[model samples]
Target: MNRSNGGAPHRSITAGTDFLHLAIEEAPGGGKSDWLASRIRLALADGRLPMGSRLPATRVLAGELGVSRGVVTEAYQRLIEDGHLAGRGRNGTIVVGAPAAAPKSPARTAPPLPRSVFAAAPGTDVFDTMRTARARIDLSPGLPDLAAFPRAAWLRTERHVLDHLAASDLGYGDPRGTPALRRAIANWIARNRGIRADPDEVLIVAGTAQTLTLLGRVLRDDGITAVAVEDPGSLGARQHLHNCRLATPPVAVDSEGIRVDELRATGEAAVLLTPAHQFPTGVVLRGSRRSELTRWAREGGGLIIEDDYDAEHRYDRTPVPALRSVLTENVAYAGSVSKLLAPALRIGWVLAPPRYRDALVDAKRFTDLGNAALPQLVLAHFMESGAMERQLRHLRRHHRHRRDAMIKAIGTHLPSAIVHGAAAGLHLTITFDAEFADTELAAMALARDVKVHPLSWHSQRAHRPGLVLGYAASTPSDIGEGVETLGEVLRRGGAGPGFVR
Candidate 1:
C-alpha cells in the first residue's frame, strides 16, 4: 500500500514519474521540477486534477521518483500559488475545483453513448444533465449577477409583506396574481419602460417562458399558426415557442435590426422580437427600421409581441422606450424581473392588446391560477417602495465593470474577435473570423471544460462563427481567465486536437 505523505504517491519507483509519463531523462541532466510542474498543469488542463482529489506528499513522491523532495515541493507550490491546489492542515494537498476534464476517445472496450433530445426512456433530469455537461469556463448568455442577489432586501420585503397579511389572505388569492402586484406593475411600466398601462390591463404570470406558452396557446386557438422570429435571435425563446407548437419562421437581422422587409414578405399574423436590446446580436432597431415595423403593424394588421428583455440594464446609451409605449393597441408587451431580480421569483407582468387581454387572463387562470400571492405582494412592495429601482442602480455599476473586464480580456487575449452589444445588457456577443465551425468549436470548448453558447445555436438563418458570453454572473477574474482559456483553445487549433475524444 502506498503511504501518501500529502505531496506525491508513496508507491514503488516506476519508469514514469509524471502525468505525461515523462521518464527521467539522464541526458537532460536536470530541470525535473519544471517537468513536474508542466505535467501537473497538463493533468489539470485535461481534468485529471479533479476537485477534492488528494495529492501524494512531496517526500513520498520524491522517494518514488528517486528525486529530491525539493523538486516535488517546488512543483506543488507553483500550483498552490496559481489557485489550482489548496493545502489542508493534516489532510494534505488537494486539488480544488477547476474546469471539467476533456473527453477521452472511446476504446474498443468502451463505446461512447449517443446523445439526443428525444430518446426512449429519456433521462429523468434533462435540465440538470445539460447543465452538468463539461465546459472549461461557461460564457453562456442571459445570466444575471447571481452572487449579488439582494438577499437582505428580499428578506425585509418578505417579512414586511407577511406581517401585514391576514390569515385569510393565505387561502388562495386571485388567479391573475394579487391585485396589489398588478397595480404596482402598472406603475412600474409607466415609470421605467414608458408603457402607460392600467392595473386591469396587467396579467401576472410566471416569467416570459410562461408568457410565451400562454401566448402560444391563445394564438394557436385563434388560427395563427406561425410567428416570425428574428434570425440569430434567442434559441431559448425559439425553443419555448416551438414547445408551445407555434411554428417560428426565421427572419434575417442586420445592423439596424431585424429586416422588416423580410418580415413583411413572410405575411405572418404576429412577430416576436427583442426590440429594445435584441438578443445574441445586440443590435437595436434603428429609426428607419422601427418606423417601417410600426407601419407594417398598422397597415398589415399584424400584432407584435414585444419582449422588452434587458431594456432596463443599459449603460453608455439613453434608455429606449418599448414599442408598446408608442402603439399599445397593436403590440402585446411583456417584461419580467427574471433578468432584473431573479428567475427563481418567476414573477412578471404582461400587457396584451384589448382583444387578447381577457383571453390571456383566462389562459393564465386555467393554467396555474396566478403566481404565488405572498411573493407578488412582496414584489409589489418592492416596486412601490422604489427598492427595485435602487437595486437596478446598484446592478448597473457592477455589471458595467464586469462587462468592461470581459471586453478588455478579449482585447488582450483574442484580438481578432469583435464584441457586440456592449452598449447595454448583462452579456456580450463575440464573433471570430476563423476558419472553423462554431458548433465544433463549442463542442471542443465543452470538451476543454468551458461553457459557451455557439452563435450558430441561435441562428435559424446562417450567421458567422461566434459565442455568446455572459459576464454578469462571473467575477472579472473568472471572465479574464475564461476568455484567456478560450484564446488558448483557439490557438491550439480547436480544443486540444488529438487529446479530445
Candidate 2:
C-alpha cells in the first residue's frame, strides 16, 4: 500500500474529499498551504468553484486532506484578503468574487421594476431584482416598522391555537379562509375601517397582488374589459393587472386624489384606487373627490376596488373611512395587515359587491383551496385578544420618530426637492426643481447601498422626476445617513437618464 510522508494512504490523502475537490500533493518546497491556495484559485478561475459556494470548515477539510488546520486556514485567509471570499458570521466562508483577470459577466442591465419587459432596459422584471439587491440601508416605500413585529404575542396566540386545534383543522381549510379569521377580520373592518359585513361576505385571499388577479378574472367573466388606475399609481399593481389581461387606462392624480373626471372619460367599468393614502404622492381622497368617485361608480355601474394600503398608518391627520363602508354596492374593499403587521403574512380580506361575491369565492376555491389554517387562526387570536391594537400603538410612536428623522434629513440634504405624501404612510416622495432623471438618482443611491423608488417608475404618463423614500423599516440614523448619501450622489453630477451599468 502506498503511503505519503505523513504516514497516511496517498490515495485517500491526495484524492480525498475537500470543498471544490481541491487536493494537496506531497508538500513541495513551497509547502502544503501554497499548493492548496493555488488549487483553490485555479478552481475559482476555471469555474469549478462558483460564486456563492461555501468553503468547508478548516478543521474538517484539514482532517480529510491529512494536513494541519493551519494549512487550510492560511489558504482561506490568503483568498479572503485578496477580495475573492468573505467570512459571514454563522454563514461560514463563501466565495464572493472570482480571481482577478478571470472572465467578467456580460455588461449588467438597468435596475428592475420598470414598465416593460422590452429590453435590458429598466422594466418590472429588472426592478424586481433591484428590490432583492443587498443594501446597507433600505428606504423602499410600502414597508412598515418591521422590527416592531409582535413576535411574543404571535407566539402566545399560535401556541393557544395549536393546543386547542382539532386534527381536522390541520387539513385543507375553506377556500375563502378559516371562519375564525373571517369573523375577526369582519370585526376589525367594522371597528377600524367602518365596513360592516357578514363573515361569509369576507373572502380571505393572499395579499393584494392575488386580490388583483382574482378580481381581474371575475371582472372579465362579467364582461368588463377595462380598469382605470391612478397615473402615478403602483407599478407592481399595474403589472399584476396587465398580467391578468385587463386593460389599465391611466387617470391623473392631483393634490386631493385621483381625478374622477378623467376616470369617467376612460370609459372603464372598474377602477383601482388607493383612496386612503395614494401611493408615491401620499394624497388622501378628499371628501369632495370621494363623493365624486362614489357618484361615478354608482351611475355608470363601475366598480371601485379600494386598496386600503397604509390606511391605518396615519400621522398628522384623522382617519379616512373606507369607500366600501359608504358605497358597498360598487366598491370591492380590500385591506391587508401588510403595512400594519408584516407582509410575510399574506393574509387579507375582500368585501366584494353582492354581484361578484359568489363568483369571486368560486374563483378563490379553485385557486389554492385556501390559505393555511394555522396562521389564520393565530391572526384571529391576535385580533380578538387586542394584541394587534397594542402593536399598532407601539408602531405609531416608533414610526412617527423615524418619519420625523426622514423629514429632517430631507430638509437638510434635499432642500431643493418638494416632498409629497408625508402626512401618512411609510414613504414620502420628493420632486426636484433642478433637472435630472429620477431613475439615475435612485441607481446612484443604490450604488451607495441606499434603496429607493424613482417616481417615474410608478407613473404611467409623463411627469416630473422625483424619488420615493420609505422611512419606517430603517433606524433614524440609517434614514438620515441614506438621505445624506443621496444628496452627495446628486452633488456629484451623476443624475441623468442613463445609469451606472
Candidate 3:
C-alpha cells in the first residue's frame, strides 16, 4: 500500500456477507494477528473506514470476526504505532490524523447549540447567552469553583449586614462605591499587591467590564480615542473597548511582555495591559519590560489601563509587583474578586490618575448609580474578617491541583502539543502544529460537548492556532477528560491542530 499517496477506492459492502467476504478465517491457529493487521491496513488504505471513524471495541470486534482478542489487540497496536489510530481514554479507539481527502464512513454530529452559538450578538446579556448554550460538557474559561462558593459564610455575613442595616443605609450610597468596600479594597491592595492608595482614589465599579466601559468613555472625553492592546490579549476586554466606541490598536507582545517600542510607535494616548501574567501566553512582564513600559508612560504622556486580572494564583514564580505600585499616576489600575472570590459579586476597584479620577467617578455615579451596596459591604466584612485571604489560599491549592492534572493529561495524550501559561491563573494555552483550523477543531470538540475558546478569538493578528483552557473551575478528572476528548477530535481529522475551527 502507498501510505504517502492516495490509494485505491474503499470496498463498499452491503452487510453481513460483505464483512464475511473480507474477513479471513483462522487456519490451524496460524498468525491471526498478522492476518488481521494486513486486512485492517488494506481497509484503511482503500477507504473502507474513514478518519475520525470509531472502531468497534477490541473484544466486540474480536467476537464478530470470530477471532482471539489478542489478534485484534495486536492489529490495533500496529495501527497505533503507525500513527493511524489512538486510544482516546474513555472515548475508545478512534482514527485521529488521517488524510483529509481519504475518508469513507460517516459519523454522528454534536447534539445542538452548534459552533455558531459563539458568534451570537455582543450586547449586555451576551455572557448570559454563552453560559446558557448547551453542550455535552462545558469547559468555558474564567469561572471559579461555583460548587465551592462559601454559602454558609455568605449567609452569615448577609444576615449580619442586614441586621446592622438601618433604613437609610439601603438608599443610594457613595458613587465611588460603598465607603466600607473602598476602604476594604484599599487595605487589601496594600497588603496583597503592595500598592497603597487613598480610598478616595478607589472607585468601585461593576467588575472589569464596567471598568473598561467607564475608562473608555472618560478617556474619549479627554480627547483620547484609541487605546493600544497586547496582541493575543483578552477577547472580552477588546470587545468592551469596541463597545464603548474606542479603537484598540494592536501591539506585539514578546517573551518579556508587551513591546514598549511598538506601543510608542502606535502613539495611542492610552494602552490596556494584563501585565501581571499576560492573558493567553502567561508570561509575566519581567523587569526589563516593566521598566521600559514605565519609561514609555513617562515620556509618551500616555495612560496605562491595567487589568490586574487573576494576579493571586502564582505557582512556580514569585508574585510580581503591580504596575500601579510602580507608576501610580500613569496606570489606571483595576482589579476584582472575580477570580479570587466570585464574579457574581460585580465589585471591582479602579485607581485613576488624578486627571481622570473625577470623570471616572462621574461615569460610575451615572452608571447604575454605582455597584450594589450590600455585596460591597459584605465583601468588606469578608476582607476584614480574613475570609477573602483564606479563600484565596484555598483556591491556590485547588487550582494548582487542576493545573497539574491538565499538564499531565496533555503530556500523556497530546504529546506533540506545547503548553503555555500554566504557572499561574486558571487556564493554560495549548498549541499544536497542523494545517487544519483550530476553530474547526473547537467546533468538533463542541459537537462532542466540549467547549473551548479558539485562540484566534483573542488574536487580532495572524498567529498560530491554539486553545485557552481554564482549569480553575473544573475538577481534575474533568480537566483530563476534556483534554482527552480534544485529543480524540484532533486525531480523527474532525479538525487538525493549529487550524481555527
lDDT of 1 by residue, 342-380 (tens): 989898778999888888989998998788888888999
Tens-digit lDDT track for model 2 on 1-501? 343223223111232265357545655755888788778888778876667676777878888888889988998887764446666545566676665333356433444334221122334556667656666678888877655677767888988998999999898888999999999999998888888889989999888888999999998888887889998999889888888888889999999899999988888889999999999799989999998988898888889999998888888887788998899899999888888888899988888999999999999999888898888999998999999889888777778888898999999998888989878888889998776667777777776667888888788787888888999877665788899998898877744435322
Task: Residues 200-283, candidate 3: write the lDDT tens digits.
Answer: 889998888889999999988888888899998988898899988898889988888999989989978899999988998898
| Candidate 2: C-alpha lDDT | 0.80
The lDDT values for all models are 0.78, 0.80, 0.77
The C-alpha stretches of model 1 lying farther than 4 A from their native spots are 1-136, 494-501
Q: Looking at model 2, which ten-residue stretch has the lowest summed lDDT?
A: 4-13
Tell me the TM-score of model 2: 0.75
Total residue pair clashes for candidate 1: 14
Native-referenced Cα lDDT, model 1: 0.78
**TM-score versus the correct structure, for each prediction:** 0.75, 0.75, 0.75
Which of the predicted structures, 1 or 2, would earn the higher lDDT when compared with the native? 2
